[model samples]
Target: MDPRDWLARNTFHHSAFQDLRRLVAEKERQGLRLSLCIPTLNEEKTIGKEIMLLRAELVSRYPLFDEIAVIDSGSSDRTREVAAAFGADVYESADILPETGTRRGKGENLWKAIYQLAGDIIVYLDADIKNIRPHFAYGLVGPLIERPEVRYVKAFYDRPLAGAGGTRPSGGGRVTEILIRPLFSLFFPDLAALIQPLSGEYAVRRETLERLSFPIGYGVETAHLMDVYRAHGLEAFAQTDLDRRVHRNQSTGDLGRMAFGILQTFLSRLRPGGGAEALPELHAMLRQFQARDNAYELVEHHIVEEERPPMIDLPAYRQRRGLPP
Candidate 1:
């Protein structure tokens, strides 16, 4: 399908899904179970509110979500405690698949959630959104529940950044605008239609999620878009407009590290089979300069975008899902 046609057909507004009763009825008619996963590092302040609003609105009042889980990355803060206090089922990421060992990244928590949560569809929301709302969950899942062909629904919104001057409107983010967009436009033009490819909020079908490999770092979102588009084309995806998303912004140096990881993943997908294993050994070090008291110092960060194989390939996941080995 043409990108414009796809955009016209697939792009949606969150308001289109505000009727929770209709959405819930459709979900029940389809016999679909929905799970919400909030991946956290240290988001104690916001995690509680996100869980509270989502659980109260989606779970308690509407029964749109079967479970609301916080898959924590062993936060030193009270993120898990706060989530649990608000009636969310909390699980430490490492504890879910102890046999495979632990890798500390948001993607790791997301990949493990597929194994830990019992739902036909899983919605992933970042733990750091200050403007927490139930629409963040239901809006993404509405497309999946209503349309069987849409295996993934990505969230796009007006990102408002707070500054000394005032609030300024922004597009996706620094890394997305500077790096990912150009890369996608060059190679994966169909994916460029997505307004916010790097947004941390999306809902994906369990079957589709399990079939794709995961990069356990900043590269995960980019990898998912490439793989899904490659496998199912742009028709398999839909995007929802969530209006505004408020959150903390990362500094340029941190974005540099993220960009480095994302670039590594993007280059690897260019090869035949589009697998990380096909690439030659590449350096994982991200070197940046820091100005310290009239002097420039080099700071090196080791950011290897290690990948986990498809969840369907894992024997443990298959056993848990009761699929034939």
Candidate 2:
């Protein structure tokens, strides 16, 4: 399909799904169970509000979500406490799958959520959004609940850029424009239509999600888009315009490490067999410089883009979901 045609049909705005009553009616009519998963590290400041607002609106007021869970990556801060205090069902990522062991990353929490939560459709939202709102959850899930054909719904925000005439909507952050977009345009042009492919917000069907491998690092989101598009094509994906999102920005050095990790996952997917095994051994160390007392110092960050197998492949997950093992 033409990129423009796909965008025209699949793209939507948050306001389009603002009628909570109608969304709930459709959800019940379809007999769908929704789960909201907020993946966190040290987000005590923001997690509480995110849970409070979402639980009050999506859970209490509308009854749209069956469960609102916070899958924490063992934060030393009060993130888990605050989340639990705000009426969210919180679980430590390490505790969910003790037999498989744990690796610290946002993706690990998300992978574990598929096993721990009981929703047929899982909506993942980052815990660091300062401007928390209900549309963030409802908008992403609306497409999946209403359109059975759409297996994944990604969120995009308006980051205005000044052009020759005036300001217009830009794509995602630095790494998205500089790296992910160009890479998608070159190899997977259909996916390039995604306004913010790297956005840390999306809702996916359990059947689709359980069948996909997750990269437990910065590469998780990137790998998901590639794998889903490869298996189901662009037709199965949808994107929503969330208006604006405010959050802390990462420095160039931090983005460099993210870029490095994302690149490793991207290259691995390009191989014929398409998995971690397909790629040759890669150096996990990322070398950067830091200014200390007006002098430069070398810093090495070990960022391995490790992966978790599809949830459906696990006997425990199958048993938990009451599927025949």
User: All candidates' lDDT scores?
Assistant: 0.91, 0.92
Clashes of 2: 0
> Which window of 10 residues has the lowest lDDT sum in candidate 1?
159-168
Candidate 2 weakest lDDT stretch, 10 residues: 159-168
Q: How much is the lDDT of residue 294 in candidate 1?
A: 100
Where model 1 places Cα greater than 4 Å from the true spot, the runs are: 159-170, 273-281
Per-residue lDDT of model 1, residues 1-325, tens digit only: 9999999999888878999999999999999999999999999989999999999999999999999999999999999999999999999998998999999899999999999999999999998899988888888998998889999999999632333676565468778888988988988888988889999999999999999999999999999999999889999999998878889989888899999999988887787654445678678898999899999999999988999999999999999999999
Clash count list over all predictions: 0, 0
lDDT of 1 at 50: 95
Error (Å) of candidate 1 at residue 135 is 1.0
lDDT of 1 at 8: 96
Clashing pairs in 2: none
